[model samples]
Target: MPRKRYAEDLSVEELRLLLIEKQRARRQKRLEHFRRSGRLVVVDDHPTQPPLETLASRPLSEETPPATANPKHTRLDRLLLAIEILAVLGLAFVLLNGFTLIRDLNREVVAMINQPTLTPTPAITAIVLPGGHTPPNSPGGPRPNDAEIPEHLRPVMLSLPELPTPTPSVEQAIRIQIPAIKVDAPVVQGDGWEQLKKGVGQRLGTPNPGQRGNIVLSAHNDIFGEIFRDLDKLKPGDQVILYSNQRAYVYIVQQTQIVEPTRVEVMAPTQEPIVTLISCYPYMVDNQRIVVTARLQE
Candidate 1:
């Protein structure tokens, strides 16, 4: 028997030719099987031509096995795929909205922390009290009764410069009439001693006549026409008519009290339209102050 040739003994050219022959044989076998299964069809114009030879003449790309038919996608499969896509999109949208909300809240908190704080300043402060006077017809004449002022605050009163007197206007209190006390007096701008000498003095910084807040009017009980001599006699509901250049505003007396000279709170501002009348107490011995509070008549 003849011995078979080993692959190791073959030349390079011969090995290459051997691989080509084996590939052709495998392709031919696959093409024949496909033809029998009706996956491949051949038509020849010349009846005498061999089908194998014709197939071998075609390109290698054409000799590939027929592809299997793709599986059909059902409605349920399509629906599931669409649902997966929508769920992904919805999750993305929620994440975006959550991030946006968090960012806005952070901005608001930062703004609140950076905002400025406001402090309220009181409209009235503790200074010298009003309605101080000497004895009626004293030998040296009438003067400020400085003995009543607290010793600690005496320097402040002496050092305090007189505020500029406001110009007379129609909006300011020009006259005051209290029929219950049989008193009618002229009203001036300031409550200083010189201003009080002219007539009843309206305290500076108080509200105007008929307007909101406290309207402080002061006068001496024994001197300067003794404008508020009988202020204590006014009863509740007694009318106190205050006149301006434009018109007159009537206020009803509410109450009266005798307070210490340092009890300056009686001159403080009020929320509603009101008036506070201040005068020295008693007939001639002027020491404590008598305060009469009245509310504007509706």
Candidate 2:
């Protein structure tokens, strides 16, 4: 081999950059070898390599090779990514019943980790009033159980004019928005139910406004392997808006909860109208179900 050029061969700044380039080239060759050997890798070739300091230090949370990412020649990154993908996919396959199980679970679990956790606050709890505080003539009188509407006991309530005929309008698909990532995915209802696994689905039931229940919708985080790649970037406060019949129903994200595939109670009816968005964790397959619930903004 020819003698290697020393740092003295160039200016100080040039030397630092040249060193990075050398390291990068060495990285590329190794990556090429892996590719030839049929190993999955992160592929990124660049003129300017990251600083040695950067390669040496990092925040622990960002250790993975990235979603659907090609090899960047880092042993740690590649190893971590392989581990994660394997773990997520294996669990999903064991629990869910399909090939896309891993992808689904990855999307859900990863999204959960990426989402903002909302803890109920004592201050908010204090705002709620105890029953029986209202005056006798007040509109909201004391009531033991809310299920008994006072109007049911009055003759005048029966005389109320027949409810206006419901306008016959075609049902429409809902829209989802992710401000932080600039993502706009049309959420088809029920697709989150049984029809889609490692696939997208549209809701089957007509969306009932003010129903005080879960209106579930779902989609594939990724398939044919293109990554949202940023599906993992959905943070708390993300807006999942639904537009139908020329009206936009807004849902403010509350919290992201991860439940085992068998935990069906989380999808149970709520006391207030809310929208539930479900998808596989990480992206692309239904390994685990991620349930994102948002109450309609009053």
Candidate 3:
């Protein structure tokens, strides 16, 4: 065989012609071999690649693959989308249930804790003498001798008109203002979540402001506008004003304390007119309570 020529020995035009000739010969040989073996079903005499126009015009359904996506792939995409939606809904459902359960548990714990620790203070009916002293035993003092009172005044007292019983109003708290902490918020009736969410809440059955017993009020420290968020900042002698039925009742802070949530003695009744404010301890945690007690400033 003659000596083979290396690609580096050929000029640019010569190298191009040589490659074209080699490719043409290879194609011719392949066609003849396939023909002689009776394996060729179609033949093309083109010496170069088919034109773009010819390829584009060919029937895609028969000669080329379909352009539309596979049916199985489409179904898989739809399934994946549905699963993602389901996952999001499930997560939301779980979160809602968790919040409800937590609220219910908290309410239960509060009910159990506040199971009437001390007896309510009894109403006082006393007759004070001019010297400001009470005589004999408590609750049933002896009747003074008739010489002490004029005979004419005693008959007048016996014939005194019976005063009508005042009707109790169903109004809830209207407003609250704490001067020291600069808190002014509307007050709601119940200590439930809905009421607290609006503002401060007054526990049902607790004495109203200016009343003789304890006036129990509570709010969240970290939520519901954080009306009592700065409760711990208050010192004794601060003033809190609660408005009800268009009347304002002022209270002077007496003490502040932190106790476990189970300690319900803070809500007990007292003979003196007082107000109690309760909030969760440490800002965001409900592990303890911050109790702030104030007495009505007559």
Per-candidate Cα lDDT values, in order, are: 0.84, 0.53, 0.71
Which model, 1 or 3, shows the larger TM-score?
1
Q: Could you give candidate 1's per-residue lDDT for residues 255-287 as a string of tens digits? A: 999888888878877789999999988779887
- Once all C-alphas are superposed, what RMSD does model 1 give against the true structure? 15.5
Worst 10 residues of 3 by lDDT: 125-134
TM-score attained by model 1 = 0.60
- Pairs of residues clashing in candidate 3: none
Candidate 2 segments whose C-alpha is farther than 4 A from its true place:
1-168, 192-202, 209-211, 224-232, 284-286
Shift in Å, residue 160, candidate 3: 45
By TM-score, the best candidate is 1
Q: Which 10-residue window in model 2 sums to the lowest lDDT?
A: 123-132
What shift in Å separates residue 258 of candidate 3 from its native position after superposition?
Answer: 0.3
Comparing 1 with 2 on lDDT, the higher-scoring candidate is 1
Instruction: Using lDDT, give the best candidate's number.
Output: 1
**How many residue pairs clash in all the candidates, one count each?**
0, 32, 0
